[model samples]
Target: MKSGEWDRGRFVGVELQGKTLGVIGFGKIGRHVAHMGSGLGLEILAFDPFLAPHMAEELGVELVADLGDLASRCDYLTVHVPKTEGTSALIGADVLSRAREGLRVINCARGGIVDEAALLEAIESGRVAGAALDVFEEEPPTNRELVDHPAVVVTPHLGASTREAQVNVAVSAAQLVVDYLQHGKLHSPVNAVFLEPDLRERLDPYGELGRRLGCLHAQFLEGNPKRIIVKYFGDIFDEPQSRNFVTAKVLAGFLGDRCSQPVNQVNARSLARDQGLAVEEASEGRSRYFANMIRVELTDSSGERNLGGSIRGRKGIRLVSLDNYHFDAVLEGQMVISANEDRPGMIGTIGQVLSSHEMNISSMSLGRDRSGGTALSVINLDAPEIEKLAAVAEDLMQEEGILWARCLQAD
Candidate 1:
């Protein structure tokens, strides 16, 4: 109307009906998108490693096993995944290269999930048709080329900008405060453990240890958790309350930010159960070495990972054993854990990498199954940023003997 030109043919766009919509990360937002896309007569395919098959079936969405397969089959691909170590740059050149030609991309989720640079190249090469991005790797993105592309549409990351969303946020926050004040119910508690004053004095240290161990396991956890087996060793856990409280604490740590709901000691077990995870606890009268010890074993599709923690007399909390390797490592601050072959200069190589990055090592603990076998090194770094820690871990894994390196923010 403004240009005094009305050409229906020129404004014609592809019809979404009967087109396949592939949704990566089947969380709340992803599920909603799938439902809406289905209503619009679009076939839905989802790929989320953590989402159960039964759940997807109930929603009438076909769950694709692989990301590449989803990309190859879908006409439109939308991402709603969280930005994590595994998901960073998830839809990069490799995924785009394998996509169905003329695939239209949409990302209203977190930034850095789709490599913007790679997406731009794919568009230029005529592999990708277009893109609609609500988020970017950098807020107020500096990449003008991608933002100004003719086939691309960019938004200022306004996913929650609706009036209804604003109202919902305000209402939810007020309701949470009201519920907490009236009924002593905490939907989302900041602190890990919540206990009575008397119990706090006796069980605080043990609870902290359990939470730390769970957190450590979660950082490096592979696949969705199936079963969590927590073993209590020593006389300290003889009381029923002590064991129960600590078990909940362990779940609190393991499920921390992984769950959609707020996790506290009160609701951790229930939340774990809701996710189709089995919780088990065992008690032993005596520990092999320490006076008291708590071991958490998480079994997933990949394999089982076990971590043991104990509260030293003066050390507060210490990670005593990881899997079959036993050594004492302080369970606090930022840490870099690596599995490497037992060899000369391995420690020096790790140190040199950190030193090159100007990262200071606060403490180091080394454990091995045998003299000439694989070893685990837990090195504490003095307050390195998460980005730097991840880079350092990646650098460490590039070394000759290092098998894998994981960065842990224990704080």
Candidate 2:
């Protein structure tokens, strides 16, 4: 059964217990469904090429690298991949064409991934005995003929709708794609610290630090952060944008992910200065590490907080502030990794893995998804284990298979 399907409290085949739940797009709700389904004692198998193999192993799930492989192996194949340009109509006739007998299919992701017409044919032929869908390729797929079928169970998209579910999903995870988007999603990063080398070089040492920390704090903002104000201090004003221009540029560029176009150092500052913040301020760094610091005053949908930080070293960017929460971290390959459903021994699992590699965590941010889901955590570590970190991130993303995307925290 799909995650939304489970909480919806609609259909429960007592016979459904102990059945395998094959999922595509290991994301938020997908993971929720898998976790919740454990009461059924069902084996969880999934297919998601974008996910790393190690992450899957920890979930104790069987990972199928390819879609066809998942279909061939699963007792019930449920899809949760997104509805991107490439994913539209992904599992058309070709995918449905191959199947073992009595294969059940569920589509709680986007509607387009499965070929509706072909699915009906499979249902009629007994290749697929039952099917469930929450979304359609077309919002409210007008094709009553397909939706009205007896073998197919349908619902409007309701993945993270419950009050309890809402709070669980919106927690401290960097990307709440599943709780926010509801369905299969990629555990992708927001590219918070990406900029051209020349452009990055142009930013002052302190400004670079501000950019990284500012970007990191900005990543987990629950609601929209409409307005931002950046300010510089001390003798760092030797550059051309030392005035209002430099401040605006970083804020604008940082805000780029929410928008499509590039935000530059030129008008970026001015645009932010005029945002919704009733008041915003920037400050100087007083630490022994640097002469000054950058401070941003902003307002989000929820509440407001003052953000400050400074950078050190010749090339690498480090996190120097988290709203007065004292911590120092470099902005290179270093990562802020987190996981929830933090059961009694959840931390032990990730710790065991990190310990095996001798990786050291510089800092950590701990949180919980909800009452029952699990705990969420963020880890700041040295950049020594590059491939190892990437492997862990990939594994987490792949293992969930569109359920929860392992958001790689950065600054």
Candidate achieving the largest lDDT:
1
Q: Which stretches in model 1 have alpha-carbon errors above 4 Å?
A: 1-4, 40-43, 52-73, 82-98, 110-118, 135-149, 154-194, 234-249, 259-262, 270-274, 341-361, 382-404
- The residue pairs that clash in candidate 1, if any, are none
User: How many residue pairs clash (N, CA or C atoms closer than 3 angstroms) in each of the candidate models, in the order given?
Assistant: 0, 30
Stretch of 10 with least lDDT, candidate 2? 270-279
lDDT per residue, candidate 1, 90-189, as tens digits? 9999999999998999999888989999999999999899999999999999878889999999999999999999999999999999998999988766
The positional error of residue 298 in candidate 1, measured at the CA in angstroms, is: 1.2
**Model 1: how far residue 288 lies from native, Å:** 2.5
* Worst 10-residue lDDT window, candidate 1: 48-57
In TM-score terms, candidate 1 sits at: 0.77
Task: Estimate candidate 1's alpha-carbon lDDT, on a 0 to 1 scale.
Answer: 0.85
How displaced is residue 46 in candidate 1, in Å? 3.3
